[model samples]
Structures are given as C-alpha cells and as structure tokens.
Target: MLKTLYKGFILSYLLITISCTTNQNSSDLIQAIDNRQTDKALRIIDQLDNLNEQDSLGLSPMHWAAKRALPQITKALIKKGCNLNITDVHGYTPLNYAIKADNAEIINLMLKNQAVVYKNGLSNLSDGPFVDWTEKGLYAYYLKHDSISSKSFLLGKFINQNTRYFKGWNGDTTTYTITDNKIPAWEFKTQEPIFVLGDIHGQYDRMVKNLQAHGVIDKHLKWSWGKGHLVFVGDIFDRGNKVTEALWLIYKLEQEADKTGGKVHMSFGNHELMVLNKDNRYIANDYKNLCNNLGLEYNTLFHSNSVLGEWLRSKNSMTKINDILFVHGGISQKQIDSGMSTQEINELVRQYLISGSSPKNQDKLNQILKSFGPFWYRGYFMDRSQYKKITEQELISILEALKVSRVVVGHTENDELSALYNGKVIDVNIPLAEDSIPNQALLIKYGKFFRLTEDGNKTLLN
Candidate 1:
C-alpha cells in the first residue's frame, strides 16, 4: 500500500509540473503577439507543446496572428500545423479574424489550410454584412468583384422590406457614383441655421431620426435643410453594428446638401483616424463577421482606393464657422504655438493619410497625432497626468490665434450639451449614437446657441 501511494503521488506531481510549464509558455506566446514581437512569438510557438492554448480572451496564437494581419507569423504557425479551425471565445475561427483584418495573404493561407467557415450547420454569411443585409434572408450571393467600382461588374440579390430584388452591374460609372474627392473650404461665415452633433458611434437609426426631427432631413432621409450647414464633429465609426449604413447616409446627405447650396461637414475624429490607421481594437463583432463574408478588412472598405475612403480623406480635421471653431477635440496651447492654419492642418492630415509623414515633418506629425492634437485633446474638459489643463489665458491665446471667439468640441461625453470656461468652450458630445434613446445636439441660429433635442425642442444655452 505504501509503494502504491508513492507511485500515485509521483504521477500527480509530474502531471502538475507539465501543466504549469505549458501554461507559462502559452502566456508568453500571447504576450509576444500582443507586444507585436513577431519573431519572439514564433519562437515561443515552436517550443510550445499545445499551439491551440487560449489566453483569457479565449484567442489562441493563431487567432491573434490572423487578427493582427501578421502574415509572416501566420505562415510560421501554419507550418507548425497549428489547429486552423479553432474558434475563439467570440465563436470566431482564425479564418474569421483573418477576414476581419482583410489580410488577403493570411486569409488565403487559412483557406488553403481548410479553415471552416461554418461551425455546425449555418453559414457565417447568415449573420449579415451591412446594417440591414443578411445572406439567408435575402439569398445574397457574394459578388466576384468586392467593391462597387466602374471597372468591376456587380451581381447580387437582396431583399429590402420583403421585396426581392436583383442588381446587376451595368458597367456605368454613373450607376455606382463615387463622390468628387475634393477637400472643401473649412472656414465659413454663414448666417444660415447650423446643427452640430457629437460622436456618432454607428447608431444609424437614431441619428437619422435625430436629424429628421431637427428638420435637417425629410421623411425619406434626404437632406432638406437648404442652405443650412450640418456638421458632424467626427467619430462615425466603430462601436455599433451599423457603421456602414451611417457612413452611406452621411455620404448621400453630403452630395444632396451640396446641390441645395447647403454644406455637410464631417470633421475627422480620433476613431476615424484610428480606423484609417488600421487600429481595429474597438470594432464590433458584427463588423468582423461582416468583413469575413465580404472577403475584406474594415480599413480596406475605407482605404484610399475605395469610394467612401476617398470621400473620407477629403474631409477636414477642423472647421471654423462665424467665430465658432468646430473640432472633434479641443485645441491645446501647443497646437496654437504650431501656428498651422485650418487649411494647413487639413492638408497635412490628408498628406499623412495618403503617404505617411515625411521624415522632415516627423516632429510636426507627432504633435498632430499626439493626445493633445486637434482630434484628441480634451484639455477643455479636465486635465490629467498626461494632459495638462489649459489655463484661461492659454485658451484666449488659442482662440485669438485661430481668430475664433469660441470653440465647440465633441469627444468628452456629457449628459447634456454643456458649457465650460464660462461658455468659451461648448461640448456637444451627449449620449447620441451609443444607445437607442433620443439625444440632444447643439444648434447655432440667430446669433445664439441652443440645445436641440430629437423632439424639435430648442433650449437656449449662453
């Protein structure tokens, strides 16, 4: 009995030791991937006993590699015969993540490895692609050409409001319209009524209703505010599942408003810049699966080569209307010191997006992309260890430099549209597109500012 007990204890100890070592190596591999140490992750994977070991997020090394679009690391993992079809905690396979990244090389690698697209019986396509588009419901077929371009032929079937429809590419550039990709003037001195809203995190339905109620759009969701200006202070990406729909709505409104002698301005926000830069941390799961079905990445949909992508590039980073400066984030004193005009700032941002910043302009680009930059600075609300408070004198100097009386900003979330610094700075970033309930926005008309709600009620503010 004593000898048997000794053997049992020895076996248990060995198993526990092996388990601990495997867990440690697995953790190290994940950390390497997160830190973007591709070579180190590859090395760890080679030494790892179980390549499918998951981290707390239930994503294995393969999933992370594919999600981050690290083609070399993905190839290394494939060579090691890692399980390609392993699903993460989100019920997404490695191939799904690769598709989300829109990484063609990695996606092709996974497909060649026989990564499963369906789990049990339903195709991942059944989950849908756009806001109100689903394969199962519409019997939608994947087009040979992914984008709606003049050169590519589009063929697909869809159902809207229970009406079955088929759309065939006519090879006409007019059929699939690409907006005139020209940057518009950012400075305006208009007396027409202005409606300004904050970050719209992909809540398309809520945004349409909010605009409709405020008399910006008519019943058909077309721009009806003739000669009036509608400004969206950045952030029409990520979070909600209807980002694509919201973007299309804005795109349509922009064109219609232009025809009616009105203007629709979408300033670049932090999320917009982040998405354009290929940062997909905050993207919704719906988008991941949708992109998987589309055989593209999220950024690819808005890349310089695509239609909406070009339109987005044409947008400004900041706009000034009648002494009121509208920016996604408030300006800092450092930005004031930079002395970049509104047009220069827009031009620089556009250049950076197109080809990245030149080495000579690296220092200036750093300041622009920093937390204290135009689309990110929140010093007007409060200061932190990283962001110091902008004093009243500093604010005056910034406004005077920009030749604006007040600055209106979004990004700092507030319960309602409020004023700070004795009404010098106004925040319109209420809970708008993040939820289903109606939210308020800032309205500037008749030389007075007011808070406009979805019910068309306007309350004067300073």
Candidate 2:
C-alpha cells in the first residue's frame, strides 16, 4: 500500500511540471511578438517544448506575430509547426488577423503554405458578412495577387475624360468648344444695336424702375424694348440683394437671344475687374458673404498669375458700333499712339482674360492698369462733375486721337439720372437714391443717320 501511494505522488508532480513549462513558454512568446521584438520572439518560439501551446490571450505565438504584422516572426513560427488555422477568443484565425493588419506579405506566405482563405473551412458564399468581406477584402487580396495589372487599370482610369485631373492651367491652348447647342449665327444683326451696361454697385430697385420706365422690362420680365440686340456692361456682382436674380435674368436673355435672331454683347466692368483682381478691400459689405458662398477665390480668379487671369488679359477694352466707342472705363492717349491693331488689341484682351491670379507680365499689367483703360482711369470719365467741367477742346482732342466721334461710359454714380456732355459723351450712372431722377440708358439706333434715345425717349442730338 505504501509503494503504490509513493508512485501516484511522483506521477502527479511530473504532470504539473509539464503544464507549468508549456504555459510559461506561451506567455513569453506572446509578449515578445506583441512588443514587436521580432528577433526575440523567434528565439522564444524555437525553444518551446511544445510548439502548439496557447497563451493567456488564447493566441499562439504565430497568431500574435501575424496580428502585429511581424512577418518574419510569423514565418519562423509556421516552420516550427504552429497551427496556422488556430483561432483566438474573437475566432480570428492567423489568416484573418493578417488581412485585418493589411499585410500583403504575410497573407501571401500563408496562402503559399495552403492556409485557409475561406473562414471556418467553409465557402464564403454561405455567409452574409462574407459578401462584404469578400468584396472589399477579396478585391484587395486580388490586387496584392496581381499588382501589375491592377495598377495599370488605376492609371488608365486617372486619364479618362470628364476627369478634372488633366484640365489644369495651360494657356489659350485650352479651348472650350461652344457646347451651348443654342448658338445663333452672326447673320442675326438687329436694326438697333444693343447697349449692355455693367456692374451697378448697389443702385438696385432703382435700376429696375429705370429700366421699366425705359420699356426694357414690361409688366412681365420679358425684354420688350431696345430691339433684340442686348448689350450688358459686366460687374453685376457686388452691392445688391437681387444681383443673382438680375444676372440670372440677363443670362436667360442672353441664351434666348442666342437662339433667336438677336445679339448680346457683354463688356468687362471695373467692378468685375476689381472682383477678379481680389480687390477685397474695396468690395461692398453685403457682397463679402455672397462672394464666400460662391467660392469666389478672387486671388486665384483675377491675379494675372493664374490661367483665368491670362484669358482675362486678352479681352477687348471696348467695342465700336458706328460712330460711338463704348468702353467700360475710358482710353488714354498712350494706347492710341501705341498703334496697336484691332487684332492685337483683341489678343491683349485675351491674355488679360486668361492670366489667372497675378499677372505673368507684371510690368505690362501695371502699365495697363495705370493707363486710361477699363480697369483704371476713373477720375477722368467716372466722375460726372469732372466730366462736366472738362473743356470741349480737351474732349475733342482725346476723341480725335482715338479716331472716335463720341465716348459712352458708365463708371460714375450719376444721381440726376444720365448726363449728356458737350453733345458727344453720355454718362449713364442710373442713380439709386429715391430723390434722383431720369434713371436711363442711352440707346443708339442705326439708320442712315444715327438716332440717340434716352431710355425709349427718342431725341435728335446731332
């Protein structure tokens, strides 16, 4: 009886010793892997008395290595005969852990070793989450499998049309073919030339009333008067609540005129140039929020530095209709003396329009801005009192130098309606105040002799 009892004691001691040894090895191996000590983890795994021992976290050293993305350690454990399909508390096998880590290297190694791709040794189609897993996960898996082909497709898609990637700032070379299917031919010249006025700062509701009194807008929003040809001097952006509505109506009219046998000519205004030039310092208080809402990065839009600025630089300063030279601002003697041809002027305008942010030609841009042009020269023409004071001799000399009979401008804020100067120049700064009167636009009708009309009120000025 004593011999049998001693033998049982020895057997129990041996079993406990073996269990403690396995547990200690598993704990040390998992710790090394988790800490990213790849070299130490490999050494610990190799010395393991039992290769299949599970850690306190229920992960084999192999699973820990794969989860931590330690590919070298994972390979060493696999060679030691660690079970690749052994799952943890979360039921994530070594392969699943690798996928979650996004480690393509370890995943390929496991696949090459015939590790299971389908979960629980079952086909993925049998499970619901497996569909999502396979789509996102399997796509990445295949991409890793055939990297060359997948990358090629990605490159091709980047170059596809309708993508914004290629449509970057080049120059005038970037041509936009007139895609508006409603374009009318030049054969549709109206008997009366249209006069489009540009940016009216504030001066709202009053501008509408003036146009209505002039018979431009009837009881309906229809453009009834001034024949079919419509001219809009630009700006139309700052200092008005109905700016968007006004621009929308005008834009609609432009489209309508294009479809019909009519014409619409728009000139660049100083305010438009100001907005384009990022003269935010001069922008009205009401327009600041609207500008932000429209994502108008003025610096990027108008500074001659960018592509758009280059295009703006190329726009014509003014258009000639018979005897009158209608300009946004007014021209100086220097421009006329420069002997620039109409085509050259048009090209310069194109450059101005295209140069996006800051002017590429800084000196030239400054020269143009400082000269008596659309963007500059406000003191001479925009100031009505100044215009009224200038002698006829000075006016005739300037007009003669430019080879024009008369000048029509819209820069000054004329409170007494429109001003007729020396029977040659017309200032149409339709006043905004309630006390102001004769809010009007000068209409020039082309007959054998030119007939000048204020609003619809026709009069002979010659």
Candidate 3:
C-alpha cells in the first residue's frame, strides 16, 4: 500500500511539473476552454497575443468558448477585440456556434456587438429579428416588448402559369417558378458515368462548390452533367444550418436533370426520418429557433403542403445503378434473409415518412426504422454487441440475395472513403461538414471506381 501510494505521488508530481512547464498558446487556451478549465482558459486568453489564431480544424478560442457555452470566456474574447465574425474551416462563425448551443445571452451578446449573422446562406439570427421561409412565404419575426411577433411583409403567390412572385407591402417584387416534383427511378442500367455523394448534412456551399468543381453543375448552378447520373445516398438534412438551402438545391437539380437525359436520385436517410418523426435531437438550433419564432413544429415546415416536404416524401430509401446498390446505411443479414425486396423496403419506408408519427413499439415499423433497418444499420462498419458482427460468408449471402456486386453506404463515418468486406462494401461518409479535408465523392466511370476530389481529379480505387 505504501509503495503504490508513493508511485501515485510521483506520477501526480510529474503531471504537475509538465503542466507548469508547458508553453501557453491559443491552441492551449482553446483546449483549456474545451476542458472547462475556466480560470486557466481566461488567464491564457489574457496572456495570448492572438485570440483569432485558429488550430488545425479552424477553431480558435472564440469558437471553442461559444460552442461550449462559456459566456464569461465569450465576453472576455469579445473584450479582447477578437473577430466575432471569423469563420472556421467549415464556414461556421463564432455566432453560429453560439446559436447551435442555444445560449440566448451569448447570442444576444454577439448580435449586440455587430457580429454578422446569416453568412453564406446560413441563418444565425436567433431570439431576435430574423427572416426565414415559412409555409406561406418569406416572413420576418422579431421580439417585441418581451413578446414574439411577426408580419408577412413579403407574401409569395402564383402570379401566372409560369411564374410565382413575391410581393411585399411596399410592392417590392421578385419572381421565380416552381419545378414539378417527380419521383425518380429506383433502378438504372446506365453506361454513363455515375457520381455518388454521401450525406451532405446541410452544408449547402460546400455541396455546391464540390458539384460545380466536378462539372456536375455549371456556373449558374444548373445541371450540366447531361446523360450522367448523380445519386445523393440519403441525409440532406440537419446540422450545418443550411438544410433549407441544400434541400432546395436538390429539388432544383432533380427537375433540371429530368429536363435532359440525366437523373438525380435522393434517398432519404435516418435524419430525414427523425425530423418527420419529431426527433429533433440532432437538429440545429437555428432551425429550432425558426420553428419557435414561427410558432410551428419543425416537422410542419416539411409537411405535405410545403414544396420541399412534398418532394421529400417521394424520395427512395435505396436505389440500384447497375450491379451497385446505394443505401444510407448497410443492410443487415437478417434484413436480407427476410426476403424483403428493395422496392418493398423503399415502399414501406416511404409509408412511414408519409405517416409522420412515432414508430416506437411497433414491430412492422421497427423493422424499417430501427437499427436493423436500411436507414439506421451500421453492422458493416462496427459490431453492436447485442447483435453479432456479420461474418464474410453472411455478407456474401446477403449480396448474392440482392444480386448486387457491392453495397455503398454513408451513415458510418470514416477518415476517407473506404472499401471493406473484401471490396464488397464501400463507405462514403467522410464527415465533410465537420472536418477540413478534401471534398470527395465516389465516381464510377464505365465499371471502374475512382475517388473523385473537388478539383475534378479522380484517383482510381481497386
């Protein structure tokens, strides 16, 4: 006992010595804030020469403090004249972090100090004057004398057969046309190049830039990849504050692609199911605040009446292009063994989406919406102890049953796009929205697979 105690004392003394001798830096300050060492972080903040200096992932002290909801550290950074509007590598400002945390005091503090909200098509204005697209049209909501109030100054209406215009009370006019939403084909045998994008998670600008760079969309952001197919394998919602913009872009692209010989497939993921089922745990605060300001539920924004909502309901949960099967999550051995066809899976999931209710405690609903479902399964990537990991032979039997060469999925994140299961499964979820890595997509050109980067460069994958 004495020997063990003496060893513990030496280890503690070494730790203290290391801590005392460590050099102070902005990165250290950010770490301190993340560790919740409030007093130490503050002292480091005061001693640091540059508060805006970012670490590897483009996070500074301001970003960390705001995200962690440390108001005192936030105030200290503001007092130090830190750039309030400084965006991280992922194009998120400190105010965006504050808004995500849902800290009203920090949000108000940033707004009062002239921090720019709504940068790059993302809404950061919460608990104050803000504008968002409602079911009717673009409306403005503001806090008035401790009570919330709103007025529809810009009322959008269908003015003509080919045009819809937004007319303000002051007669300010803007016009656009809505596209006819059509459900895409489930299976394709195209010889043309196929591009597969993983979960976007509402990073509109990043998605657009990646598409534009790859010549999928032109400078005007219209479909340019004629005769080629683009598949978004589920998850175009939640996180990153640009869900609205991302959804609209996909909507627009779907119609444009139909105009030519091209096709765009939108497969609904678990996040889509969550929102429709009133699961807002992973939802961004900006959206929550928008719903609060409008006095409506979050799911109501995407109800049948709304254009995006109606369009989303028509999406598939899985699609097949040639011998490749694209799904949001992996298919379990049991799911495949049940002899459920891809069409049946899509149909059942679509029905659940349309119902827009809790799927809890129901055996039929649980099969499609629960962990073993196509939208939630991750057995290919990791093993859940309750459910044994699928063996190589089980995977082979599953693929043979589906008649697919390989299955592509996006729910499980990886450091890079990876091929596993003896090249039978591919994981495209690289966590693009959270990391400062190269934007990549899986490109299949004439039966050859390649990792296509944002610069239109393709690296062949075996």
TM-score for each of the candidates: 0.67, 0.49, 0.65
CA RMSD for every model? 14.8, 18.4, 20.3
Which numbered prediction scores highest in lDDT against the true structure? 1
Better of 2 and 3 by lDDT: 3
Question: lDDT, candidate 2, residue 57?
Answer: 62
The true-versus-predicted C-alpha distance at residue 296 of model 2, in Å, is 6.9
lDDT of 2 by residue, 410-447 (tens): 66655533435555666555544334355455566653
Off by over 4 Å in 1: 1-116, 120-176, 292-296, 433-437
lDDT of 1 by residue, 1-462 (tens): 999999999999999998887788888887888788988888887877678888877899999898788988888888888898787777777877876787887875675465644433222222111221233453222212222221111133444435433332323111122344687899898999999988888877788888988889999877899999999999998887677668877887888999999999999999999999998878877666545453656675566755567678888999989999999998898887887777888889988888888888888889888987998898987887777788888898888888898999998998888877777899988776445545888889988899888777778887
lDDT of 3 by residue, 231-273 (tens): 8988887876777667767776877888898999889888998
Model 2 accuracy (lDDT, Cα) = 0.51
The alpha-carbon deviation from the true structure for residue 84 of candidate 2, after best TM-score superposition, in angstroms, is 41
Relative to the true structure, how large is the alpha-carbon lDDT of every model? 0.76, 0.51, 0.74
Candidate 2's clash total is 43
